[model samples]
Target chain A: SAVISQKPSRDICQRGTSLTIQCQVDSQVTMMFWYRQQPGQSLTLIATANQGSEATYESGFVIDKFPISRPNLTFSTLTVSNMSPEDSSIYLCSVGVGLNTEAFFGQGTRLTVV
Target chain B: GIQVEQSPPDLILQEGANSTLRCNFSDSVNNLQWFHQNPWGQLINLFYIPSGTKQNGRLSATTVATERYSLLYISSSQTTDSGVYFCAVGGNGNQFYFGTGTSLTVIP
Candidate 1:
């Protein structure tokens, strides 16, 4: 299991503003992912952050809205751009150590857009 | 893409009671994981049972890969188990598709 730490555990941001959440892993990992969970709802994947490259996004998410950066194997960031009330949700980072392996998630950053 | 479904959508149990949570997938998978998200919002990995059975403490999980379904059994439940239980699966890649989750409330 990997230890993942996310910064700014919770934040209050105004609409139109953006927030960047950082995720730091205890050790090097091959793949990193970002997910979103609305208030009282299931999680929805936002993208797969690759080390030293662009992130792969899900169906309803795009880079313009959720820009990701994975500068190294142990660090990644997800920035929610142009925030809206609908964008208010808990953002989580996860990683898988191997093929057919279990994934571990961060405690999650709770964002409230007003 | 794989679809994961979990049921019953909501469950209420008494402390020290036992219950079962089921997860169904739309297709064959190489990965199946169970997670418990506590009230404070910490997602903890419980089991990664793609097939067969696994146990840890008072919790155990069984996965029948051929049937595309898995079961999580919680024995001697505690209030600490009150939260949402999510089951996720991956078909070809490591990326998982998650279910809506079973919101379990264990009341004392």
Candidate 2:
């Protein structure tokens, strides 16, 4: 089992500002994923961060808007840039031990744009 | 991309009542899980039944991969069980697609 710890449980940010959320895992992992859950919506995958390579983003999401960094196997960061009111949502990070394994999630960072 | 649809978008149950949640997937999946998101927005993993049945305490889940659906059963509900339940499925890729969650409100 993997234990993920995400920082900044909740943050209220001004528009046009950027916030970087960090995720740390208890153990080393090969792949870490970033997700966004808009108000009253289900979670949507933002990107997959693999150490030593560029994060692969999902459609409708781009690298410039949500840049990701994976400095090592146990840590990753996601930055929401040029934020807008529409960007107000809960961002979460996840990690799975391996194939066919149950995935674990962080407590999630709630961002409110004002 | 796979489509995951969950039934009973919202539910209100009395304490000690029992309820069942359903999750339907559009394609075959390699992983399926049930999670409960508390009011604080913390997602707690409940089950990881990809192709079989798993029970933990008052909560149980069954996944029929061939039928392309899964079910989560909560027996003897309590006020603490009031939260949003989500079902997530993963296909061949590493990404997991989440279903439209079922918001459950349990009252005493």
Candidate 3:
């Protein structure tokens, strides 16, 4: 169980702009995941941020659109590029401790594109 | 990909009432978790019961991996428990398949 803190808890960004959301864990974790939740919708995995390597993007998600960076084990950031209204969603960060252990999530970043 | 399904898309309850949230998965799973998404959108982990039963305070969860289903029981429900409950299942790797969630509203 690690505490995950996410930055820019909320933001109102203009279209065509880009916003980077950061996830910082209190302890080192083996798996750090980024997810997007649309209004009144379920959470969808955007990508799995890997340490010392590029993020593994899920189907229908691309690194060019949502570039992720994990400089170390405790810190990772996901950038939403060329924002649009469709990209407006609550971006969440989740951390996994063990194979069968529960995953902890941050408060989430609520992004609004206008 | 694993399909996670949650029952009773919406629920309304009075304070002190009891309710059950059901989650059914399409495939085998080694790990299962339950989370509560509060009014402001913070995901709070409730349980990690892959199998057997686990209890915490007023809430408890039972997962039968063989049956591919899990149940979350809320006793003496409070207004604070009003929110969406999500059940996610993970297997073989680090990916978690999340259910659409059951939205509950407990009126005072």
Per residue, candidate 3 scores C-alpha lDDT tens digits across A29-69 of: 99999999999999999999999999999899999999999
For model 3, the stretches where C-alpha displacement exceeds 4 angstroms are: none
Q: Which of candidates 1 and 2 reaches a greater lDDT?
A: 2
Model 3, B1-108: lDDT tens digits are 899999989999999999999999999998899999999898888998989999999999999999999999999999999999999998865678899999999999
Give the winner by TM-score: 1 or 2. Answer: 2
In model 2, the runs with Cα more than 4 Å from the true position are none
In terms of DockQ, which candidate is strongest? 1
lDDT per model vs. reference:
0.92, 0.94, 0.94
The list of candidate 1 runs beyond 4 A from truth reads: none
Candidate 3: DockQ? 0.72
lDDT of 1 by residue, B56-78 (tens): 99999999999999999999999
Best by the lDDT measure: 2
Pairs that collide in candidate 1 are none
Candidate 1 TM-score to native: 0.97
1 or 2, which is superior by DockQ? Answer: 1
The local lDDT score (0 to 100) that residue B100 gets in candidate 3 is 97
